[model samples]
Target: MTGKIRVVVAKPGLDGHDRGAKVIARALRDAGMEVIYTGLHQTAEQIVETAIQEDADVVGLSVLSGAHMTLVPKVARLLREQGVEDVLVLAGGTIPEEDHEELKREGVLAVFTPGATTTDIVAFIKSSVAGAAA
Candidate 1:
């Protein structure tokens, strides 16, 4: 808790809907984390680069395109490729329940589907990052 929890909220792939991503970004900022939002249509590489440039503690990806499987793992791989193993990778939006375990296996810390509240996301990131730092 010594420093602000920095997080990058991004929309990856061809997904154009950004209301959710923006909402989460604002919520994280209001919760005291430094939130950087990489706007719409970002590639996995771009998200990772922004995360690195921002020195983020977490990367929050919002994908409504049902391409979570493809995009999440790609971002995770890019993070690992960049030697950013400590950054928590989380995804939300229209994800099926069955894919949650698979995403976790691919190194995503948590997956948030629809109906997940802003408080839940914020708390999850805060506690998860704090625990990691501990």
Candidate 2:
């Protein structure tokens, strides 16, 4: 709505795998949104700092280290603590269905597990941001 949606795709914690994050970043860019990838091995602080610096509308985390429970909330908490309350936080990776509610309660907008398509990610982001604006 306000120019192209600005998103920061980050790989937080000890997760060494970045192929998924890279693919999502390219897909988001291809869909006409501005994507800032923070690369891999980012701390929650780094991700939140980058989001604020970039004035990101959305923050997407890619985690496959089974640490989503710890990592997601840390990122969300840091974002709020830094006063970026309007930033939409989301995650994608090996998260389980049972963890969805807990993640949402911690302020994650949504969580996409494996097998989620890029189109769905893009669409969900666009609609979620748009809806939040409305």
**Which one wins on lDDT?**
2
RMSD (Å) of each candidate, 1 decimal: 0.7, 0.7
Cα lDDT, all candidates: 0.93, 0.94
lDDT of 1 at 127: 90
How many clashes show up in model 1?
Answer: 0
Where in model 1 is the C-alpha error above 4 Å?
none
Model 1 TM-score, 2 decimals: 0.97
**What are the clashing pairs of model 1?**
none
